[model samples]
Target: MLTANAAAALLDTEAEAADIRTYLATQERKTLLRFLTCGSVDDGKSTLIGRLLYDTKLIFEDQLSVLEQDSKKHGTTGGDIDLALLVDGLEAERQQGITIDVAYRFFSTPKRKFIVADTPGHEQYTRNMATGASTADLAVVLVDARQGVLEQTRRHSIIASLLGIRHIVLAVNKIDLVDFDQQAFERIIADYESFVSDLDFSSVVAIPISARHGDNVTSVSERTPWYAGPSLIGHLENVEIGAEDRARPFRFPVQYVNRPNLDFRGFAGTITSGSIAVGSEVMVAKSGRRTRVKRIVTYDGDLASASEGQAVTLLLEDEVEVSRGEMLVTPESRPNVADQFAANVVWFDEHPLLPGRMYLLRTETEEVSATVTHLKHRVNINNFAHEAAKSLDLNEVGVCNLSLQAPIVFDSFKENRSTGSFILIDRVTNATVGAGMILHPLRRAANIHWQAMDVTKASRAALKHQKPAVLWFTGLSGSGKSTIANLLEKKLHAAGRHTYILDGDNVRHGLNRDLGFTEEDRVENIRRVAEVARLMVDAGLIVLVSFISPFQAERRMARDLMGDGEFIEVFVDTPFEECARRDPKGLYARALKGELKNFTGVDSPYEIPENPDLHLRTLGRSLENMADELESWLRERGYC
Candidate 1:
C-alpha cells in the first residue's frame, strides 16, 4: 500500500531487529568464566581489572565521565586518567588508594563472558582474598616486576590453590617500570613457579604487563616485542576449563524442607554438582535412606532433569527423613561419613584458634559442634614449609585434626570443593572465625563406636530414686562457688539423694595434671571436668561442678554435652573487686605482681554468663541461704 522505497525500508527494519536478537542469543550462549586478581600491595590488581573493563568496552559514557573527574581528584597517576578508579569504586578505597575489600566486576569479549574479583593485597585482608578465591576457576596473581616474589604474593597463591583454583596466570605487572626487560620478567616468573610448584596447579602461565598503560592486557604490546605469548585477555578467552562439576557425583545440599500443604512435601535446594533426572534414586547422605525422585519442580513448572547450579524443589516417591542441613546424593556414590577428619584451616579471627576449644563447624549441609583436637602443623606460605605451632593466629593457615559431635558427609576438597569446604564459628560471638577444607577422615573416627550397655542413665537414676542433673557452678576464685556447691551437695546427700562434686583444683592434681594456666589449657580443663560430670550424672549422681570456667564458649560446650534440661548453669555473681580483695589463695596478688599469667579476674578475662539457670549474689546473701535457695528451686522442678 506504500511506495517501493517505504516498503523496502520496513523490511530492512524487521531484518535489523532479527539480526540484533540473534546476536544477543549468541552472546548469552557464550561460556562464562569467573576469576580473581590477587597479589602483593601495589601490584596493580585493581588497575589490571580496570584495563580489562575499559578494553572490553563495557563502561557507559556517564561512568567514563565520572571516572575522568574522579581521576583528577583521587587518582594516583598525577592527573592522568587512572584506570584503577574503574574498579576501586569505594570512596574509602579511592581516598586511601588501596582496595580494602573485594571488588567484583563483570565484563565480556566477543569470545567469552567473564566475572572478575579484584581482591585486597594486604596480609590483614588475606581472609578477603581467600573468600574471593573460594569460587574462582582461575587466579590472575599480579606481581610487581620491581618487587619480585613477595610474601603476600606467595600467600595468595597458596590460598588460591587451597580454594580449588587450578589455573593461574602470573601477571608480572608494571613491566614498563622495569623497562620491559625480558630477563627481569623471566626471573620473576622463575621465582614464582618454584615457590608454587607444590601447590598442584594444573597450569601457570606468566605474562609481562603494564595495567596502567594497557600493554599486554587486552592485546600484544609493542614494548614487550621480545616476549612471545598470548595477552591476558587472549589466554583467558581461550583457556579450557572442563565441566568437572556436571561430571561429578550428584550432591544437593537441602537448604529448606518445603511443606506448604498437607498434600505436598518437597526438599528445596540448589544442585551443587552433577546431574539429576526424574525417576533417579537419591539417598540421604548421613542416613543412607534411598528414594526415587518423583518430580523436579521449578517455578516455571516441572523439569525432567536438573543439573548443577539449578535451584528447584525435588519431590520424592516416598517420605524420607530429609531436612535442612542434610544432603541428597546419588545412592551408588556416597560421600565420606565420619566424625573426625584432618583439614587445612585458615584462621580469620583476632583471637587465636586454640586446640581442644569447641567451635561450631558449618559445612554446606551440616553444622556440628567440633574441636581442633590437634594442630598438626602451620604452613609457612613463604617457602611452603610446615612449622610446628600451638595455635593458629590471625591469617595463619594450619593443618589440624577436627573431631565433630556427630558424623557428617563430605568429600575431599580436591575431589569436590562445594561439599568439602566449611567455616568455623565462635560459639559465643557467632562470628565466622576460620575457613577449612577437609583433607580426609581420621581412622579413629571410623573405628570407634559407642558400645551400648544394658544399664542406661534412666535405669541408673530409677535405681537411685532421683533424677540426674549436672549442677555447673561457675564463677571467679573466692566467689563462694565451691562453698555453696559443697553445702548444696551435703544437703542432697543428707536427704538420701545421690551426689558427687568435681572441684577444679582437685581435678587438676589428677585428671588434668599436664595442663597449664594458659587460655587453651583452661578450655581443656573445663572440657575434661564437664565429661567427668556427665559420666557421674549418668551414674545416677547429681554432679556439682565448681570451676572458674572463664570463657562462655567452654561453658556452652559443657552445656551441649548434657541432655536437654539436665545441665543447670549456676552463676556465682560476685564483684571482681571483692574477689581480688578476698584473694583466698593469694592468686590475685601473684597475678597483680606479674608472677601469675592468665589468672582470672587479674590478667585474664572472664565472660559473664548471658543467661544462667540460677544467679546467686554474694554481696548480701549468705552461702547457706544461697545453697538452700538452689536446693529449693531444684525440688520445685522435681529435679532432685
Candidate 2:
C-alpha cells in the first residue's frame, strides 16, 4: 500500500500531467455503461463520487483549489469536505440544499469508462429519475446506515427494476456513523434483499463504505472485517453489460424525415431496438407498407449497416408515404397495432389524474389523444402493497387504462424503451403532466370480411352534407355555451351547412350523465365530448362543441384528433362575478354554497386561454353581439 505522502504525490503528478483538451478531442468512445446514483438528500452519494474522482486522479489542481476554498467557506461540523456543492448546480438547488435535475458526469478507468447519471432522490422528481434510469444499464442505490431502507429507496429500486436495469448494487454509506456494526450492515442488506426478491433482476450486490473516511472504495479496508463483498468501485469495474437486443424485431421510430433535397429522402432516428442493414427488409407500421433499405446514411458517411444503440438515417428503395412520427420495423416481428392499452403512470402535477380526461400521449414520434379509462390501483411505496384507487394525486403512482384516438404501433416497455414508453402532455398548456409505461395492449376481435371502406373526405361529405370541422368554445360556466351553440346551429341551417352541436349539458343528459363535477369526472366528460366531436368531424359535418373545457389537456386532445386548422378554440373571457350573476342553472349558487366539488370557478383550477382565435367577452355584450362574434369567426375560418 502507498504511504500518505506517496498517494498525495501520485495525485499531484497526474493532475499536473492531465490535458482535458487532448482527452476531449481523441478520447476513446465505445458502448457506455450508464448508472444512476440515488439516495435521500442527506445521503453521501455526492461524497462517494467526489472521492472516486479524487482517488482516480481525475480532479485537476484548479478544480481542487476551488473545491478546497468552497469547503472552507461552507465547512460542516465534520472534518470531511462538502462534495454536494459540486453536483447541486442550480441556485434553487443550493438554497433548498437538494438536487433537482439529472446531473451527468463522465469518467474513465483503465479497463472501462463510465457515464454516471446522478438523479434526484426526492419523490417529487420521480419522473426525472425515471428519465435517467430509462437509458441506464446498472443502478447504484445509496442508503444511509442509520435510516436503513426508506420509502424512496424502495421506490427507486422498483423503478430501476421496471425499467429493465438488472444490475443493482446497494451502497450503504456513512457506516462510520453507525460504528461500522456488522449487524447493522447485515440487517439493512437482508431487508433490501427481501424487497427486491419479487423484482426481475439479474444480480444484486451490497457494499458498506464510509465515503468521508475512504474505507473499502478502491481497496478493501480492515475496519470492516465482517464485510466480505467487493468494494463499490470494484463492482462497477467488473459489472458486465450484455450487448443490447439486436436480434429482436427491428424497430426504428422516425424522429425526422431527412428529405434534404429533391433526390434525397431518408428516415432518421436512434435505433431503440434490434438492428438493420443496407438491403434489409423494413416495414412502416400502422400503414402496413413494406420496402427495402437502399442505403444506410449517417453524418460520418454512408454506412454498410447499423446496429442497436446506433443512430443512423436510412434511404428506402421506394418513395413510400412515410413521415416523421412513423415507425420503421421488421414485418416478421412487428409490434401490435393498438388504440387502447393499460399503462402504469407516475402522476407529477398537483391536479390529480382522473379517468376519461383527454391528454396527448406521445409515443415515439407519434402524438395522439389518450383518455384515461380506469384507475387500476395506487402503489404503497413503503410496503409495495397495491390498493384500488379512483384518482391519482401529485407524486402518486398508479396503473390506468388509456384509450388513444387512433391505432399506434408499440411494444411493452419491458420489451423496448423506444416503443413502449410515452409521456402525457396537457392539451391546452402543452405541459408534460405524466410519464407512462405501456403494460399491455387491449385488442378487439374482428371476424367480419366486409370490404375495406376506403372512403375519402368527399365521399363522407356526400352523406353528411358539409365539410368536417371542430368549433371549440371555452370559458367559465354560465358563459353562454348553450346559448351560443343554439344560435350557431340556427345560422348554419340558414346557410345550408350540415352542423352538429355537442352542447355540454344536453349530452350529459344522456351520454355523460353518470359523470360528476369532480376534477377527474370533468376531465372524463370533456374527453367523451372530444371523441364525439372527432367522430362528427370524420363524418364530414360542421361540429360545434361548447363546453367549459377547463383543462388544457382536454383541449389539446381535441386539437390533435382534428390536426391543425381543422379544430379551432374560441375563448369566452367573462368575469366570474358576471357569470355567477347570470345564474343560468343555479350552478354558481351551488358552487358558492360548496355543494359542488371541483367546480370550475370554485375549488378546481381553470387555465385561461392565452391566444384563442376569437375572444368574446359576454359580460357586457348582448345576445346578438355574441351571435355576431360567432358568425364572424365562422367566416374567418371559411365555415360560411
Index of the highest-TM-score prediction: 1
- TM-score for each model: 0.96, 0.84
What ranges in model 1 sit over 4 Å off?
A: 1-13, 261-263
Clashing pairs in 2: 356-524, 427-553, 427-556, 428-552
Which parts of model 2 have CA positions greater than 4 angstroms off? 1-31, 91-96, 243-249, 256-266, 286-294, 298-303, 316-321, 445-474, 484-502, 534-546, 559-573, 612-614, 628-640
How far in Å is the alpha carbon of 544 misplaced in model 1? 0.9
**Could you give candidate 2's per-residue lDDT for residues 508-583 as a string of tens digits?**
9999999887777777788788878887877788888889999776777667678557788888788888888988
Give each prediction's root-mean-square deviation over alpha carbons: 1.9, 6.4
Query: Considering every candidate listed, which one attains the maximal lDDT?
Result: 1
Across 52-152, the per-residue lDDT of candidate 1 in tens digits comes to 98889888999999999999999999877888989888899999999989989999988999999999998999899999999899999999999998999
